[model samples]
Target: MHTQRISGQAGQTGRRWGALAAAAALVLGAAACSGGSDGKSAGGKVELTYRIWDSTQQPAMQKIVDAFEATHPSVKVKIQLTANQEYWTKLQADATSGSAPDVFWMNGPNAQLYESNGMLLPLSDKLAANGVNLADYPSSLVSLYQHKGKQYGIPKDFDTVGLWYNKKLFDAAGVKYPDDTWTWQTVQEAARKLTDASKKQYGILAPAFGQENYYNTIFQAGGSVISADGTSSGYDQPAATAGLKFWTDLIKDGSSPSLKSMTDTFPSQFFESGKVAMYYGGSWNSSTFAKNSALKDDVDVAVLPQGTKRAVVIHGLANVAYAKTKHPDEAAALVAFLGSKQAAEIGAKESGVIPAFNNTQQAWVDATPGFHLQAFLDELPYAMPYPTSKNTSVWQTQEPITFAPAWEGKSDVGAVAQKMADLMNTALSKEK
Candidate 1:
């Protein structure tokens, strides 16, 4: 969830929320453009706008909306697709001007910010009124969108990271394919063998991102990003340093591309193009890989290699309604329906995302054959909830900047990690 590096645009601003002046301008522009919500189309039917970031999932989302409309008939939902990197900024701008979409996708990193600011409508009372059981979703995911004991969102889908490998590269290097039994040592050995310097190919693509990279290894090494209470930082710990070294060592050994190269090309792209033999990717990439002609046949996923233990960062997206929506009842109804088992199944069948509703994920697995989709579900037992705090974006945005030297091999991991801890602690201290 560390401001996904997939598109590389996230790193361009340095701050996920733009500067004060830019944000003010956005607020002014939004206010000038804002119109009070009508919540009804010219046909007198309730109309709601829904926004989300993943264009890959838009078709499936439309299917969900169609299903919802079938039952209510009076409610119409329009889907708005925004790029991930710009989602939060636009949401903030719209939120400030009381013109945010009636319902929008919310993630762990920004949920607290919106909830605390009273921009999000709490769904607890409505969920209870509808007899919707929170237990149907992952406990961690449910907790993620809750602020001060009030649930502001309903989990839509979830994902976990895995080690994705190219079978052809493993075969050519005479290295065994990665499996549940593989460990850090096994990965290093395989990486060294699979790396082909002459061809500009590396064994793996270890970018300096969190969710798809170091965060999992850090947890696997018995280290955490923050304390259980969310009051302090954990980066300075020895275990944390060891986890970071896992990727830094790969960079040092020429088994992965330099941070500079990864900046130019995302790790997922490198894997898809066969420039890297393996990649630490999230379950969300399943649809992408299935659609990529170059990688569909050769790519497969496995459990992430264990360090001191096995761990994966689990995160999800939730559906939250804007607090100021004129059609509060309609928005709440739409959110409830979207979080229902039926909607979850639709999402799983079409989007290939692990539906948050329990017992509904098999559809996603069955949607794509030949790849081990179960590997993501298998990680649930040891999975760590993606790290979050009230001001997650504040500290998270500092990661690439503070750790650049270490990731680029210009500074020692321990030293850089200590600095990160200091900066993170400073950020945490400012949050209520």
Candidate 2:
């Protein structure tokens, strides 16, 4: 979607992201971080470092840190943050030097990598001691941090993919808005009708992240991202290939923007500006969307249309402690405080994302007027998660090259999917 700038804002098209800061403040703020605890920590007067990415979330994280500090006056929390990629790289460097932060955010892809290399201290016992229940979290996320029957982290909260659309564009096209009942077929038809290359408006943005962008679609077509064992590629699996074809066909037919256009566009601004009619992403966008005064009321969300099957991917984070911390007890206390309903609610209210904990998630959705963010809440039951296995990231780096033609509009998507499978297998063999 393109924006009509009245001036002020930097970027290719003068799209302003300044509102994101205010949008983040619109809902819950520190309640998310503090609601987690009222208990005091054991006396140690220990100061430990916590790390995360995304300065956008820093205020919320700092609030969480402050609450942790208040509850445990003896335990002081220091926060360190960086971009997502840089955070991981720096954490890895710290791991090599045996100087990692006490607590850090861990996700599916590298969760196992950290746990397996002994960089993360397992929390199953700590959780049990604190009376924290794994049953409270979505199963996919709980399982994502578990390897070989041992859980190394606590399930923070979960998010699901959705269809965000520009209401203005829908009005212009004389098409009704999408809702929970819309299907992939209906979305495609709308895209074909709504698309106008002359205006640089396309149907959707199909990014290259297999797990982030295509995993939901692939599995929605009745396929799994990986085998039951998490040992082999699921791309060559027939259902998975058919799933890849579904979106690739849209690109092939020009119903969506080319991958190049996607990379070049300032995405956060585009969705609100109406340059793209629908964005297939997750609920995390709720806060960002709520902030845009230019598009807030005019924009909205819907459940992701079903593919051959009805499903959603459950993406979430795990707050894992470092293995080599000098403050293991303090780290454990922080994790427990963080897992409490209060902390979860703080994250929900401040972050505008669903709280990983039960009950608290509703508070966030209830706070949104017309958003009914509950669609993602309902999707939680049907979400799937995949942790980066020892070899997953290796294939991830190569996925765009293998899956390129599908979105590039040059080759048979199914064939490229098969080639993707072969390439992954080649990488997997080297892992042994």
Quantify all predictions' global Cα lDDT against the true fold: 0.81, 0.68
Candidate 2 positional error at 294, Å:
2.2
Q: What RMSD does each model have against the real structure?
A: 3.8, 8.8
Can you tell me which runs of candidate 2 are displaced by over 4 Å? 1-44, 266-268, 366-370
Q: TM-score for every candidate vs. truth?
A: 0.89, 0.85
Off by over 4 Å in 1: 1-36, 83-86
Error of 2 at 314 (Å): 1.8
Residues 1-432 of candidate 2 have per-residue lDDT tens digits of: 001111111121111111111111222221122111123334545777777665656777788778877877777787887555356556555665556678887766666556655667777778877768888877877888897788888876666767888888889989889897898889889988888899988776666655445777788888876666767778888888777777786777787777786667644555666778887755666666777777778878888888887877775677888776766777877877777787887877675556787778777787676675777777766777752565456666666777777678778877888887887777666644
**Ten-residue segment with the worst summed lDDT in candidate 2?**
1-10
Best by TM-score: 1
Candidate 1 lDDT (Cα, whole model)? 0.81
